[model samples]
Target: MPFELEVCIDNIESLSTAIAAGATRIELCSSLALGGLTPSFGFMQQAAKQSTVPIYAMIRPRQGDFLFSPQEFDLMLADINAAQEAGLSGIVIGALTASGEIDTKNCRNLIKAALGMGVTFHRAFDLCKEPTTALEEIINLGCERILTSGLAPTAEAGSEVLKQLNELAKGRISLMAGAGVNQSNVKGIIQQSGITEVHLSGKGFRNSLMTFNSSNAKMGADEVDDSQIPVTQHQAVANVKAVLDSLS
Candidate 1:
């Protein structure tokens, strides 16, 4: 079977780029620089309308940590509801306790709230003190998939852990290798981790042009700062094709 590639997108433009680039699936998000945040309702609706592939909305409320407060958890629940109503194909989320263990109760509640929608436990799996225990908790919560980097900073560093997790999963849940995954190392990650599903952004950085208004200038200096600008370069379909070729 062909390995599956799920691209992580930060906006409508990125979504369009991912689809054009031949990504089979997408994980919709915002603030890619600070990890990711939940995309707005309108953004979700627009993405669903524009893409043919399944888009899984990221449910993270903030960028700090996986641990959430009661209020933050409530916010997450509300976002999930909004995303589901907006016709998202799935959700990417996970929660942990103060002690860095899976918050089974909170996770269960989130799973229940996402009924009829696909659920993927996010990288919080790597934050748990014990992955084996966390995997069991996640499986029991009925998460359809778990995106991980084998508890390491990158897939290459976590390949061994990923392999172990894959073995322990035993079809109970999908182990999607992510974090620093790319064409150069995707094949090695798959071969070592034995994971069928993989995640990547396939993005590069581009400089954005700065616009300045002479009329609004003060002290003869341009009102808008143009010294530095960087933007994400959405991968082309050929990038996806390259990864697919490596898998074959």
Candidate 2:
């Protein structure tokens, strides 16, 4: 199969950059520092208007654990409906039990709700107590792919487990390595894990255009510089795509 690079982006600017830089797919979300949350319906609609590649809206209701409350599940269902209405191509989603097992029932419902759209089970797969078991469950749930770091903090660190998962998958489902992926290490991760697909934000920070700053105005976290906005760098995305193309 041909290799694919899926770029994750949190804003319109980054969405444009990723596509210009050769992303085969786009994972649209909000609050990347919070590990990505479901984007607003307006953002989804605008992205659909701008993006050339297939855009998969992240279906996460919050930033914490994937064990969602019933209310949160209802919110996710609503978000899925909104994504469909916005003309998105698919959704990236995941759910787990408190004990670290795949929440099969909830996931099945999500897949059913997302019916015609392509489904990618997100990184909550990394938290599973049993990777192989979770892999089977995800495939049975009809997820077309699993985006994971192989239970480690980064794809490079988890390359071994990623390789094992790839071998076990045996083409049953696509295994896409993500988390801390960059141009420097992407080639190695793909080589070691034997996965044809990869995901990354290719993120970089830029100073806000505002020339004035008020010391008392702190709407976000105390440490974060609200003036500095996160953007997906076109060069960063291009470099990784070049590396993938260079590989046999």
Candidate 3:
């Protein structure tokens, strides 16, 4: 198979744009501002109804960190069940120990709960203290793929480690390079990291004019309250197309 491009979409508008742009797959989530939390069941159902491409729903309950409390893990389990029922093709999730290692038991339980559905370990792998060790453990636990920035802030900085991971993975699991990937650098990241699959969020933000009334505004108060303005952006098809074109 040729290299695979997975687009991350934050909303329905972006989902449509990505599909139109020729994306073969999508990872659906809410609140990209928070690095993606689980989308609602209704949203997942709507996306599945409208999208021809496979949609993988993010299963994270909150942001901030990858370490999940027992209740949060349970919530994730329920989310996975809901996603399965709503017709998602797969799920993206990750968990880590307080000491910064893969939470194998929780991961294994999640994998089992998925019950033949596709599972991609999310960028939480980058937060692990030992990525190579975590990669090995996830592979052993039967994850289908791992979305990573190679334990670095961006794929470019982590290219060498990602290359090592790609070689070591050896078809056992997929190493998908993401984070700060764009048309300009995707080709280099792929070439250097030796990864065939890549993930990108072709997103652009737009400021909303709508705002809440603030009675507390004073003469000296700042004219614009940053919190009152909502920013909206979605995965664009053109962004995905550009990356594909660069790879080709």
What would the TM-score be for candidate 2 when compared with the true structure?
Answer: 0.98
| Candidate with more favorable, higher lDDT: 1 or 2 | 2
lDDT tens string, model 1, 39-155?
Answer: 999999999888899989999999988999999989999999998888989999999999999999998898889887999999999999989999999999989899999999998
TM-score against truth, every candidate: 0.89, 0.98, 0.88
Clashing pairs in 1: 21-237
Q: Against the correct fold, how does model 3 do in TM-score?
A: 0.88
Per residue, candidate 2 scores C-alpha lDDT tens digits across 1-248 of: 47899999889989889998989999999998999999999999999998889999999999899999999999999999999999999999999999999999998898899968999999999998988999999999989999999999999999999999999999999999999999899989988999999999999999999888888889887898888889999899999999988884
CA deviation > 4 Å runs, candidate 2? none
**Rank list by TM-score:** 2, 1, 3
Best by TM-score: 2
Best model number under lDDT = 2
Candidate 1 local distance difference test against the native? 0.84
Q: Which regions of candidate 1 are displaced past 4 Å?
A: 209-237
